[model samples]
Target: MTVQFTPDRLAHRDDPEVSKITAISLSGTNTERVMHIVVDLLDELGPQTPAELEHVYRSRAAVNDWPVVAFYSVHKRVSQMKKHIGIVAGTGVREGGAERVQLTTDPLKAHGKITAHMQGGDE
Candidate 1:
């Protein structure tokens, strides 16, 4: 399958994760917050499906003491990020019937500064 991402073929735009991001973060815009998590996850853990991301995100957020968001919200945010920022692409692999996504080679946009709870570098 080897899914390749292009501007015309995006993953998740116009999703509610945008608004959820707004509610969750006090600083930065919705896009900034989503990019922070999505980019950081992919950068740290390699490729993962949105579901995998959600699970990992939940775990990381717990360990890091951050607010927990839903898997569906993660699913929508990952898709929207793939569309708006072009930071992620489908990996053509399915785990639990969902496409695995990976970060692109583009310059890193979110350095995880949007998160205030992340205190240590152990993450």
Candidate 2:
């Protein structure tokens, strides 16, 4: 089966997940920043552990003039993006194995959509 993605499909009002993801309330708490960083890192560095993500976030935050984000906060934002936005996908292991996260769709397209939404623009 093929899934078709279009502006109309993405704007479907009945899809609660999409609505939540596209909501114009992502400006605070570094949520949008984390999303961009995670997606960009996944594209450039491939799947990364939560620890690696925290390190990268700190580094990038300094360079980008954004506030430092905690690992738990990063994990929570990633979890929300995965569950509500479907931009990220990963598996959880309970036996002390590091979780790996990667982008589920085209990185550039996903980033653009997320950035636009975060900036209060309907994409």
* Top of the candidates by lDDT: 2
Q: After superposition, how far is residue 78 of candidate 1 from its true place, in Å?
A: 0.3
Model 2 lDDT per residue over 4-53, tens place: 33333333355455444543333343567677778888788877776677
Worst 10 residues of 1 by lDDT: 114-123
Candidate 2: residue pairs that collide: none
Off by over 4 Å in 1: 1-31, 106-123
Candidates in order have lDDT scores of 0.58, 0.64
Models 1 onward score TM values of 0.60, 0.60
Error of 2 at 112 (Å): 3.1
Model 2 residue 116 lDDT? 63
Q: lDDT of candidate 1?
A: 0.58
List CA RMSD, all candidates.
10.7, 8.8
How does residue 33 of candidate 2 score in lDDT? 69
